[model samples]
Target: GESVGLHLPTLSVQEGDNSIINCAYSNSASDYFIWYKQESGKGPQFIIDIRSNMDKRQGQRVTVLLNKTVKHLSLQIAATQPGDSAVYFCAETQGRAAGNKLTFGGGTRVLVKP
Candidate 1:
């Protein structure tokens, strides 16, 4: 399972510290990978994506690193802010030629202590 996270889904910070969230994927058949952030009571918002052909991707103050060798992925938020608090989910997409379907992993939560 690429769903590696601590329960309680929270980080008590001073509102200006950087935060690191982690995940572990279990599918070897997966190809395209993406990270999404979901705020309270809202749907996930696209963050960044990395392909199996790549190892790392970055956007704004966020950086996503992928280690396909270990089937692991991580998201790093710089200068974590109160608005960054939300649940994060790592999704693995491998087109199912049989039915054209996509798969997703469980999500992780991030709590910003502002």
Candidate 2:
């Protein structure tokens, strides 16, 4: 089993600006990565994802980048808004050998100021 959330990082941005959130994953074997946004008292909502074979993936207003060389991942939000303020996390999962289990990073809180 993998551990989740050892600590938290914070990101602040002004409304209509762009926000970047970073994460470091623990397993090099992890082949899939997802970015999630969680508001207070709610479960994480999926934002975007990238596979190990791909370096980048983009969604409506979000982009996910993976750097397997450093085992690092980053999420970029375009035109950040007050509604984008939330705790963002990166989750990784490998094949069935690891039960395809999902492991989440500590997470970064994004604050959008008016």
What TM-score, computed on C-alpha atoms, does each candidate reach? 0.82, 0.88
Residues 1-114, model 2: lDDT tens digits: 222322556787999999889899999888999898988777889888788999998889888899999999999999999999888989999863544678998888888999
Q: What do the candidate models score in CA lDDT, each in turn?
A: 0.78, 0.86
Q: Across residues 1-114, which tens digit of lDDT does each residue of candidate 1 receive?
A: 232354635555558898887888888978877788877666778899887888888899999999989999998899989888777887887853544344556676777776
Clashing pairs in 2: none
Q: At residue 26, what lDDT does model 2 achieve?
A: 91
Give model 1's TM-score versus the native structure: 0.82
> lDDT, candidate 2, residue 29?
83
The superposed Cα distance between candidate 2 and the true structure at residue 86, in angstroms, equals 0.4
